[model samples]
Every structure is written in C-alpha cells, then in structure tokens.
Target: MRFSEEVCERLDNYVYRLIDPRNGETFYVGKGRNNRVFDHAAGVLDVADDDNQTLGSKLDRIRAIKSAGLEVLHIIHRHEIPDAAVFEVEAALIDAYPGLTNLQGGHASSDRGPMNHLELIDKYSLPQFPSNPEHRLVLININKLEDRFDRRAIYNLVRYCWRISKSRAEKAEYVLAVVRGVVVGAFKPENWMSATRENFPDIPYANGSELHRIGFTGIEAPGDIWNLYVGLRGKRVSDPRLKHSQNPVRFWNC
Candidate 1:
C-alpha cells in the first residue's frame, strides 16, 4: 500500500489520519514523508505491546479492524507542506482530534495548545514565574486536566502519575500544576511511590504502567506558599527554558 517513488516525492511532508473503518472514527494523527501514511497498517503486527503502552493500544485497534476483515483507512489531511510549517499544521490537527492515538503530543503543544477566550487573557496578563527561584520545586504541566477549576481534579492530576526521578522528586518541596503557562494549582508532596494500582487505586489509568513512572500523595500548599508562587491571579512562565515542551515535568532549583 506504499506510495510509488514519484508519488512520495510529490507528496513531500504531510499530515495524515488513520481511521477505523468499522466505526468511521479517526484513531490516529501523524506527520511524515514517503509512505508513512500506510506504514501503521503494514507494520501493526511488529509493534511490541510492552514497549510503549500508547503505541500498543494503537496497534491493538488496527488488529481488531483486520480481524473483522476490514482494511484500515488512511487519509492525507494535508500534503506538500513546507518543512518549516508542517509542525504547526500537524499540531493543529492533533488539537482538533482529542482521541488520537499519537504516541506523543504535537511539537511545542504544551505552551501553545488549545485554550479558551478567558484562558487566553490569563495567559497574556498573568505575572511571569520567577526566572531564578530560591525554593526547590517541581513544575508539572496538567494540560490534560478536564476540569481546570475543580480543586480536587487539579490536585489529583498534579500529584499523581509522572515518570520522574524519585531521589530528585524527594528533594523538591512543592509541585505546581501549570496549564498552558500559568500556575493554576500548588501542593506539597508527602510521599512519592510507583505509579501502580496499589499506590493509586483511584486512577484506573495507572494499571500496568508502573515500571517506568512514579506518582506522589500530597496535601495542598499552605496559603502563604500558594500565594507566593501561584498568587491570587496565578503566575505564568514566560521563559523559553521554563515553558512546558515535549516533557511535562520540569524540576527547578533542585
């Protein structure tokens, strides 16, 4: 199902989607050159389940479609895009499709992902995070949080489920939940533990992924501590180094 050399050359860089023919739902979004659009269906059997849980899930979906005697559908959303602008096109499509099985978020997604009108205002108006902070802290981007204003939701999303150094995580005194660039929530970790069902029974998504990740149980920061860092209006990290990139976790002054 690969493209011919001439077609591949003409297509250049493109953004594509993989669809489940059974349900007419898009299951994956990706960007690549050559015959990359057809590669997922062709190489579905070779992907190891244990190596990457997210990718494993995608392969599983492809296998299910095949078992039903249906071929997976590939759609090129955009083609012949210049290399410089391909990332932005891919990222915008990723944001549009929330249920995509893409292994990682789009490039530079954390700092510039989807935001509402009020969120946009806060992002531009908030005070910048301290460039040289004296306190030890772990800045976590909770971009996946569904309920941003819910206190418990923010606490749960910020504290639990991360692939961070246990020793370095212990050295940090506080964890701040950053959405886009703003610090929306703050907490103090009491204990750090493996991200397993035993440690995080409340999080169903934690099952079988403990080998490479860790989480924490913690209390909300004291009023003064929260005010200093999060403030009443919230603090924003404008420094390029401090902004959330591909990795959601950032350790500061530790």
Candidate 2:
C-alpha cells in the first residue's frame, strides 16, 4: 500500500523491502519511521538484547536477506495515519509480494497497541549498570560512549593491549586502569596506579603501576592506550587533553 502525500507528511511512515541479495526476492515487508533506515542498515533493531528482541527478530530477518546478497529498498510513507489505514497499507504491500509472510502474527489487523518499556526490560534480562553509587553516575553517561568511541577505536585498543600483555587478565587490567585514570581526571604518573585501584576494587591490582609503566615505554604517543582513555571517558577528539601539547607523553615517559 502506498501513502498519499498528505498522509505521508503526517505519519512519517515507510515500508522497507528486504530483498534477497542473490535473486532480488522480497523476503520481508515491514513499516517504520522514514529516518530509521540507518538503524536498519546497522542492524540496530536486530540487537537481541532482551529489551528489543521483538524488533530485533524482525531486523534479523532483514539481515538474513542481506547475508544472502539482497538489497534493502525503503518505500517512505507516513506513520500518523489511522490504524485501519496503516494495516491496509501493510496488508496491501504483503499482498503485492505473495512470497512474504507476516511474522508479526498479523497483528496489523488489530487495533494499534502501545508497547511498554518496562515490560521489555522485564522480559529481556538486559544488562544493567552496577548499583554502586559512584558507578551509577557513570552509568548515566555510558550511552555517550557510542559517539566518541566507535567500534574501530575500541577494537584497536583491545587488540594492541592484548598483544603486549600476553594474557587476557593483564590486558583487561591495563585497559581498565587507563579507563579509570581518564574518568577520575588523574593523568599524573604518580597517581594513575592508586586511582585505578580505588575506582575499580573488583579488578585485581597487585601492582597497578605495571601497566602504566609498560604503556609509557612500549607504545607510541597517541596509540591504543590514549585512545582507550578517551573512549572510556567519552571525550571528544577536540578535548583539551588530546591537544598535541597536552598529550600523555610525559605520563608514559615517567
């Protein structure tokens, strides 16, 4: 079903076509806001974290199509239409593609229902932040990490530290130390070790300074260690500490 331009303006809805990459078969028909195409591309809706499995399942179907070499085509429509009209559009779209099946249990035929965020949380054992007061404050800011710390940056830091440490525990310890230092605003060589242990007591810190010592001597300036620190703190690239003049070379060399 297509949307009238008037309806499109009010509804902001669209039908996404997930076609098999190999044969251009329309494998899935679904509707969402027009701007959610990027989330579709990134498989954000497919994240199986219990909070969003319903949507995730739908997204996974699309991913399967892509994996089979299909291209996704989005037919932008409106989201503000009456439930009857929205279902009619979806039903018509599915009818146009005979092979597609309604995995959403044909719920579009019923009245639109509101979803509860807490219900999702209860159903899915989603990860929650530590209850500790100090960590709780940091949890509020965890989402900010996505903007500053892209997957590539985190991967590079993890891999580099792992290679140098020769052990996973050592690698985790090293990374967490840098993370703590960045969060607590302690960049001094003398204070870095104690600060890490104080913030993350759960992590063993027999000699917290060892990681810093190795990082200062072994890695190059603005390497994984520095990037990891910036990522954990979710600091922008333009932050003052990242400036060439204020870089952590002195701490490393110390």
Candidate 3:
C-alpha cells in the first residue's frame, strides 16, 4: 500500500501496522508519525527500536515474503488512539498470532551481579604490583615501619632526607629507593644502623637539629617525607661529598 505524508501527519493519534505477506502475520505495531512507518520499512531505526520485538518480527516476516516472491499487501492506520491503548492493542494482536510470538525479551540479558572489590579491580585491570624480589621486599619494609618506628621518628627522617636532597623531584626518588632497599635487602641493615648513628649522635634528637647534622631523617607521619630522603640518598651515592661537609653549625650557624 502507498504511504502518503497526509496519512502520516494524522498518525500522531493512531496505531499503525506493517504486516507480513507469506503467513499473513502482524509483524509490527507502533504509534508514531506515518512517515516513521516508511523509515522502519527502510530498516533505518535506531538501536532502541529493537525493544519492540513485534516490529522486528514483522520486518523479518516481510523479508521472508520477499524471498518467496510476495509483495507487502497493506499498511493500515487506526486514528485517535492513546499510547496506552496502542500498546494494549499491539500486545493483544501479537498474542493472537502464535507464529508471531516472541518468547525472549527484546534486548540482550546479562547475568552479572553487583561488583565487589575484586571484580572492580579486575574490571579496571589495576596495576599488578611487582610480585617477585623487588616489590615483595618493598611491601615487607612498608610493613616494618608500622611495627618498629614512631610517627615522629619517621617524620624527622623524611624531613631530614628532604633538606639535603638538593631538589624536590630527586627527594622522592631517594625515599622510594631507600624503602625498596629495605625490602629487597639491597641496603644492609648494619649499614643503615651505622648511618643512623653517624647522622644523629645527640639526645632528644630535637627536630631540625639532628636533621641538620646528619642530613637524613626516618619516615614520619607525613608520608611524603620519604621522598626527600630518597633524593638526598640518591645524590649522596652519586657523590659522597654531597653528604660529607661538617654539620651546618661549623659553616653557617656558628
């Protein structure tokens, strides 16, 4: 049947049909402008259109008819129907035709449940921390600080490391390196003990004083302190004299 613009313009208040020729089944039932019928017939509907399987089934029926050398027989329109009435009518019409029944819902179904922490981690593909010698050792040292050190000591160490590191960027690398060393056994424990004693020999280990003398502090509350230590240690390793000058008191603070 021919579709005219006039018929489509009047379709706003009606339900429309595109039927299959071979089995005489109702394939699609929808409420829209008449021009939409042509658009559907042309197979240009958006993804959401699949939500109405009756329409999809009808289109398939039409394809079967074409393959069997039959032409579309009719395009019917009934005007002045509310959207609710159109839906009811379409559902009833589809139910009436056994051949046109759609048992599965229109869209694809998913079996997934709410995501937990592990699922979230997997979905995002979070970085896998080093599992072998390097990272395992780092994790051990990270845990040790929790057990063996006070917050203040950690803070002082980190702060002192920062002071002598030369630059902020280098400080971060230095701290990370120290932590890594502790974890992987790269730096000997005895060496660390000696270095700590050499840097801070006095009592109360007052803030800024011991740090000024030895140029290294332990990690403290403000976790970023390690960054500074890392930088200074990196520099000191590269050039021993970087940490070799007599305490600042002899040079500037006297």
Candidate 4:
C-alpha cells in the first residue's frame, strides 16, 4: 500500500487489486501502467460514456469503502508485464475472484473466438463472405427437442432452463436457432438472470409449476424471414450437427 513516487514511476505495466480495508477482501481487479492504481483510488472519472454504467459499479464500490473511513488497500500483484500479457493476467485474476464487481472480464483480446454479437451482426448484414470464410457460431440444435422446436417453445426453454450453465448460454453470442435442418432464427442473449413465475408470468406453460426457475435472458430474435439451408433431401442438417460442426461450441471463431 506504500510506494514512493520514484518507485511508482518505474513500474511499466502491472495487474493490481483493490481490497476493502475493513474485511481484507478484494473487490476489484485491473491492469494498467504507473499511477493507474492511484487514479482509481482517487475516484477519477475519465472518459465518461453516457450509456455505459458498467464501470460505475466499481466506482460506487470504491466510494462505499471510502465512506467507512478506511483507505482502499491497493496491491500490485504483478509488475513489469508487457501490454500484450497484462490483459490475460488481469482476466485470470477476475476468473479467480468470480464475484468481483468488474464487468467484461478484462480485455483479453477476443475471449470468445472471433464470432461475437457485433461481428456476426456485421457478418450476416453484409453476407458477401469475407476472404476468411470459415465463420464459427454457437448453434442451438432445437431439432433435438422435436416436439418443442417451434419459436414459442424454444424461447421459454432458453430463458427458464436452470440446467443450462451461465457460461454456455452467454457463449452462444449469435445463436443459430436450428430446427429440422433449417436455420429458422438467430438470437443474441443480452444477459442472464434467475427466472421467476412472478416476473415472466406470460411464459405460456410456466404456470407457477416449473421445478427450477434459474437462467433467463431476453432473446434478440431475428426478423420474420431467415436463411435456412434445406439439405439435399430437405431433411435435417447433418454437416453441422452439434458434434460435427463442433458447435454448442466453445471459443467460436469466425
């Protein structure tokens, strides 16, 4: 917590932590250069984006610590890290402390491969495939749930199913909602929260009877018509089956 100005200036790049002095618990993790730690502890608001409130949570947390009349405990965990490696180190720290208020898991250089929501929106909007044509995406094969492959049923499942891991659901950045070998819809999940009958009362079948009400995300459903590839026999799509295409896939690449 104590470093002379001369010592601080010598630090090129580092990963640091902000600990709540009262409890000795780490509440935030970040990576940056000299004096970066002080800027955060000083509560400096730079580059204020009108719409982005994610960083505000961290600032609020820091304020709460200061309100208790104890200075924030700052620790430089790693020093002299190059710009390229700092992000990865910061991400590792975040993963270690999962409940930290920091959002977006540090900028670790495209964590989920190249297929992200922004990139895919641009990909499909401009369908003249790029020179690197191997686009990867998380495909949700609704065909497996044959009886419930329609729009209405699939919607409820993704939103209400507690069985689905939070990471898996989010990784489906541009979900290719497939049914009977055709791509019927593309959905982007914004965020996930525990489902409740009281909140999502309109979910046609959830009559205060679901055994588990946990992972729900508002689906960004595609518009009326979509591009679906009907196979040679107009049967199910085999080439990109969940296993075949390595879909339901992690680390999706475009």
Best by TM-score: 1
RMSD per candidate (Å) reads 2.6, 17.7, 27.5, 12.3
**Candidate 1 lDDT over residue span 165-202, tens digit each:** 99999999999999888988889999998888888889
Which 10-residue window in model 1 sums to the lowest lDDT? 42-51
Q: Clash pairs of candidate 4?
A: 181-237
Going through the candidates in the order shown, the clash numbers are 0, 12, 16, 1
What's the TM-score of every candidate structure?
A: 0.91, 0.29, 0.32, 0.48
Which run of 10 residues does model 2 get worst, by summed lDDT? 135-144
Off by over 4 Å in 4: 1-5, 48-52, 108-254
Q: Candidate 2, 9: how far from true, in Å?
A: 5.9
Candidate 4 lDDT, 18-98, residue by residue in tens? 888888889888777757788777666555421234467778878888898878888899998887787778877776775
| Cα error of candidate 2 at position 145, Å | 52
**Candidate 3 C-alpha lDDT tens digits along 14-108:** 55556666666565555555565656655455456444433555556667767887765545456657765765554444434344334221111
- State residue 216's C-alpha deviation in candidate 1, in Å: 0.3
Q: 1 or 3: which has the higher lDDT?
A: 1
Which regions of candidate 1 deviate over 4 angstroms? 44-54, 144-147, 204-208
Kindly report which residue stretches of model 2 are placed more than 4 angstroms away from their true locations once superposed: 1-11, 46-61, 64-71, 77-84, 99-101, 105-254
| Per-residue lDDT of 148 in model 2 | 26
